[model samples]
Target: MYHVVLGVDEDEQRAESAAREIANLPGGSDEKRVTLIHVFQDNPSGASATQVASVRDAEEVLKAAGVDVSISEASGDPADAILELAEEDDADLVVVGGRKRSPAGKALFGSVTQTVILNAGRPVMVTGVPTEA
Candidate 1:
């Protein structure tokens, strides 16, 4: 029963896809143990993830895929929050949706997944999208 982190960013489609993919992991569905985590870069001003979908959506997706689900929502620096939760939960794997940013985007804001990959102690699985979001 390895803990899986689905890095949700208000973008529902991306979040959903990432969760399903992780749920499809080799032993994920068989053991029925996985979790969804959404990190919001809200702070320094008081901002939180605007709810467009319920936690049930996350649960249902994995449940339908034959995996048990634990869900969480957080606000703060995206990278720090994910790594902290993974360590605290003793997660075996940290799964995140990787965004394809243009050079401009990269120049403006760095990659959270990259930072997490560099710092997280656990094995990390990053799902990279071909198209820009």
Candidate 2:
């Protein structure tokens, strides 16, 4: 079993695509198991039900694919939450979704994927989110 923490965002299609890709991976087969996690920071304004639904919907896709899925939520900084979970779970791999950014921008304010890859003891997979044309 592998710990596959798929980060979800407002674009349901992207998250669904990510979940589908994870599902198709050899390690995500019926013989294997994976966990699905979503991080939610407390935005003072709050998140609409639609955003939460996207995560729940993605979880369903992974579960239907035969992966032993666990859905969870986390608060605080995105990178910190992921790293904490990785260490606490002794995860084999950490997966994340990212939007492409300039190196300078990324370096100034580290991306969640970049930070996790640099600090995580385990392997990390980062999927870049496609900006709608």
Candidate 3:
């Protein structure tokens, strides 16, 4: 089984791309379990529509492919939450969405993707949106 990190900032394309990549990954079976996770910084009010929509899109795609899928939400640091869940679940891999950010941008803003990639013990697959120059 694998865990896909769904950030609050993610869009439909990001969600769909992650699902497509998972679906195409070799060795998938009906026995495989895929969890779509969205981490909110606070989320006192509950999940945002965007987050719900993204999860639903990925869930539908995976379900239609006959893969066992589930959705989860957490509140905390995005990178930490993702890694903790992955470790807790003993996931085979970690998949996440990324954006094209310059080095300075990443340094200034701090990237969840980079943090997860650097800290995660298991494999991490980063699917990114194409950026225009």
Candidate 4:
């Protein structure tokens, strides 16, 4: 089973890339369970259309690959919410999607991906967004 953390604001293509990586994992034909989690920075009245669309897109991608999937929504610090949920769910792996940033940009902005990688107690898989030329 895997706990996949997705940024609600991320581009759909980037999010699907993460799903594709998980779907391509060895032994994935056994109907592995995937929990797709999205942490909303702002607590909206409810899920917005864009959030729903993003979740549905990722769910479709994983399902097409034969994964049993569930979607979750939370509001808080992105990295912290993901870590907490992964630990609570006893996830075997953590998967996250992110865009590559320059070293200086990462240092200055303090990336959530970096924090999750540093703090997650389980194995983490990172899928990078394609860089625009």
The 0-to-1 C-alpha lDDT of every candidate, in the order given, reads: 0.70, 0.68, 0.74, 0.74
Best by TM-score: 4
Provide the lowest-lDDT 10-residue window in model 3.
1-10
Native-to-model Cα distance after best TM-score fit, residue 124 in candidate 3, in Å: 0.4
lDDT of candidate 4 at residue 90, scale 0 to 100: 86
Q: Per-residue lDDT for 58-98 in model 3, tens only?
A: 88878888888877677778798888888888888888887
Candidate 1 error regions (>4 Å)? 43-56, 104-110, 130-133
> What would the TM-score be for candidate 2 when compared with the true structure?
0.75
Clash numbers, per candidate: 0, 0, 0, 0
Model 3's TM-score against the true structure: 0.81
Order by TM-score, highest first: 4, 3, 1, 2
| Model 2 poorest 10 in a row by lDDT | 27-36
Models 1 onward score TM values of 0.77, 0.75, 0.81, 0.82
Better of 2 and 3 by lDDT: 3
